[model samples]
Target: MAGTIQQIAELAGVSRGTVDRALNNRGRINPEVAKKIEQIADEIGYVPKHRKKADDTVKQAGRGKRIGVVTQLSQSSFMLQVNKGIRDASKKLADQGIEVLVKENASVDEAEQMQAITELEEEGIDALAVMPVDCDNVRVKLNELTEEKNIPVVTFNSDIVGTKRYCFVGLNNWQSGQTAAGLMGLMMRGKGKVLVITGYFSNSAGSRRVDGFVEELKKNFPEMDLVGVQSSFDHTDEVEKIIVNAMSAFPDLEGIFVASGGQAGVKKAFDKLDLHKRPYVIIYDLTPKNEKALLEGTVDFLIDQEGYDQGYRALSILSDMLRRGRTPEKEYMYTEINIKTKYNLN
Candidate 1:
């Protein structure tokens, strides 16, 4: 343990010059000598110029602090926008000597989302920004990891209530739902029947959206009727079939409001049933499919929640809490409920 340079060379059976060169990067050495020096250093736990050396090694690795982003944006335009925000934020942070690493997934399920989080943990990341799959079990597991691992976790878009999280960044879901219903009532002139398509109702965001929409519709639009409600499970096939049935049952189904990125399938069902020709459709999240639907007069309006802003802000807060040790504020960020008509769609 108290080996001098001479002792190291003697024990390594190499000249002092070779050992010095290998350790200090002063001169060229053969692979065999380099391997021997490395082995002896590891065995003896040699303390080299480690402080400066470690700093320089980390510096050479990249800019400043590194944070991991785990997201589920598979194919939704909403999630894609979130990714864009992360990229722009990462680039800007790099200018300030911080690096952002992102791993984007669009799988909106608990098992897959957990796997993504697990992988990020294994990567030895300093902090995390995630849009966790909103499930009770998944949330409990994430909270456990955050507290135990000392890894800062921020939730975007949906609420992971009652946790030791850095912060929750996204809109008031109830308000967003109310806004959608208000839009639908106005577009339909507060008359005729409508069908509501919901995402996973268990997720608070999805449930709150439905509650807000229903409450507002009941409060303001007395003449408007919520004819049927369908739980789409956030799947295309189910959405399509249910919409077809609802449209047939309510031929005068003047309104259709889908609660999430379930528009792709709903749009298809409407087109197949020629429901677009009869009803006013309000879609959530403007994926390319939904954008086209808006353009083709199939989807009347798309609810725009700045998912990109949510993703970026989540990272920004997580980074600050990590690097500067700042306490995070709730500062609930609401996605702007934009109605994408033809003019705006273009």
Candidate 2:
């Protein structure tokens, strides 16, 4: 026999009313609790008699509503997880008759993002989710979209200020930077030279992270000298070149902090140098490459920004707004700043 709602409620340890709300998507319930109830329902093969009908109604109501998404640095390794989240959410939204149009840019170019936004606007997008370039033009465009056109916007991964974005979904980059500094300080034992490598100066995410790391290093680890700070533009070759040059300039460098992509270059630099003792290195993202490096003892730490959640929740929030007039519970939906080491790799 198919499991009943009562059985599901009992299994989930929730009231029947709460189960009904979660399964039917009718009322406000904690997202975690709703997820738990849904998981239990799936496990028990419990299907509500009206579920198909309710889904069909949602699909019909979602028809003709479109959400536009724009992402920067699509080629970066970290973006793989983020893009996966976007694609997953897009499929779910598509099942409900909502369209998610995505435009991926290869670089953090403000003009390119503005052009993409213009194209999506021409396509009659009802809402927008973007990884905006931190520039005056992009900020102005976002403001226009939210205020003049009345199109709700959600910024993910990277954000811009001075705009009426519905909410932001990503890491607290500054705090992550501070975390990196603290880890490096521990590894370096308080006094040594450290090098900093960043993706791009114009990117707010990278810039803020660098700022936080520098501030924390100055505050908590004043004895440690910052040997060099360089931008790699998220290119492996550039990162390798920067590392090689910095190593040449400061052979006694005791630590390194990478606030953005192109971490593969760090390994390349080590291999090329064939140093008997490598510097204590901390990089961002838990991508396969970074994971491998951690396992192989190349990187000391990895700070993951929950890339998948950043992509998924940004679209999900917009979908709720378009479908059910739901507003985000918080103005800033920061993802967890997870620290990954070899021992805890899972």
> CA lDDT of each candidate?
0.73, 0.88
TM-score of each: 0.74, 0.88
Question: Which candidate number would show the highest lDDT if scored against the true structure?
Answer: 2
Instruction: Please give the clash total of every predicted structure, in order.
Output: 5, 0
Candidate 2 matches the true fold with a TM-score of 0.88
lDDT of 2 by residue, 1-346 (tens): 7788899889989999999876654534555676688779878888764545536776676555799999999999999989988887776566555789999999999899999999999999999999999999999999999999989999998878889999989999889999999999999999999999999888999998999999999999999999878999999888889889899989998898999999999999999999989999999998999999999999999999988878878887897788778888888889889999999988
What tens digits encode model 1's per-residue C-alpha lDDT throughout 112-216? 777777787777777877776667777787778778877777778877776777767776778888988999999989998988988676556677788999999
Global Cα lDDT for candidate 2: 0.88
How far residue 124's Cα lies from its native spot in candidate 1, in Å, is: 1.8
